[model samples]
Target: MKKAYRIKKDKEFQLVFQKGASFANRQLVIYYLEKKDQQHFRVGLSVSKKIGNAVTRNQVKRYIRQAFIDLENRIKDNYDIIIIARNPVKDMDYHEIKKSMQHLFYKTELYK
Candidate 1:
């Protein structure tokens, strides 16, 4: 299943990037911010052109989306999350990508 888009506010994105906090696990960089509702976790993916051409960027987004889809319901609420693709992602395999994202999210306190 595809995960729904829940992050639509620039303010929320800013908070996650500027104030929320971040963690990296060799597979993904996660930025997350807490909220009041505890049940409203939203996620976004960012794979810039700097990462690659359209194909690579879309591939990165797809991987992030698929991973998040499996874990979204289990994540903590009232938070917005952004996944930043790194150079490390360019060469990693699919499972490695998923594991990295999972590990990073847990490290960022979004999974618990």
Candidate 2:
């Protein structure tokens, strides 16, 4: 994802997690909150140690970012979104990850 669209700050992640609504499946959990003043959406990703070591976690993040990139134009704007990887996520390929993510986005009504 682009730097401008990526949610990098600790506070931002916390704010989304605490205030945002969330949806989850076997692969990932998504948390999102509307930010009407913003011009675009911002996204954050979290992969726990239980999912894998550093390398696997990074791979999972990359997959999630790629999925977001593909869906970016179709998603509703002006929201903060966070994706958290679950244990089963480590075994998923890019297509599976993308499918899981798309499902979550739809469930959250973030896809426009």
Candidate 3:
């Protein structure tokens, strides 16, 4: 995902966490806040150190980002979304991650 399409700052993540509605499955958790003035959606990803070492965390993040990129066209545009990876995600592959994310989006009605 591009920098413009990502939530990179701590404040932004906190805003989403505090103000947004959340949805989750066993593998992933999602927090989303509608941003009516924004032209497109932006996403933030979180993978705790408790989930793995550096390489594993980075790999999980990459998978999540790629999943978002693939779903960009189908996802609602006027929201800020944050995805938090849970422990079960460490064993999941890219396809599984994507599917789990899709489930969250569908559950939240963010998927078009």
Candidate 4:
């Protein structure tokens, strides 16, 4: 993901966690908060150490990012979003991860 669309600060993630509404499935949790004045979406991704070692966690993060890249333009805008990966996600393939992400996002009703 590009810098402009990434939520990189701890404070921003906290704000989303505290104020946003969330949706989830077996492998992913998604949180989102509207930003009326902003013109685009910002997203954050997290994969905990419990999921795996550094290599596995990073791979999960990459898959999540790829899913986001495919859906970003189709989703509703002006929000700070966070995606959290669960331990069970370590066994999933790219297509499964993508499907899981799409399903969770659909529950949020934040897509166009």
TM-score of each: 0.83, 0.96, 0.98, 0.96
Clashing pairs in 4: none
Model 1 stretches astray by more than 4 angstroms: 1-4
Candidate 1 TM-score, C-alpha based: 0.83
Q: How does each model score on lDDT?
A: 0.75, 0.92, 0.94, 0.90
Tens-digit lDDT track of model 1 for 1-112: 3344556577767777998788876557788877685556778777767878888878777777787778877787677788889877877766778888778876776775
The worst-scoring run of ten residues by lDDT in candidate 3 lies at: 103-112
Note each model's CA RMSD in angstroms.
2.2, 0.8, 0.6, 0.8
Encode model 4's per-residue lDDT on 50-89: one tens digit a residue. 9999999999989988988999887889888999999889
Measured on C-alpha atoms, candidate 2 has an lDDT of 0.92
Model 2 deviation from the true structure expressed as Cα RMSD, one decimal place: 0.8
Give stretches of model 4 more than 4 Å off. none
lDDT head-to-head 1 vs 4, winner: 4
Indicate the worst ten consecutive residues by lDDT in candidate 1: 1-10
State the weakest 10-residue window (summed lDDT) of model 4.
102-111
List the pairs of residues colliding in candidate 3: none
* Count of backbone collisions within predicted model 2: 0
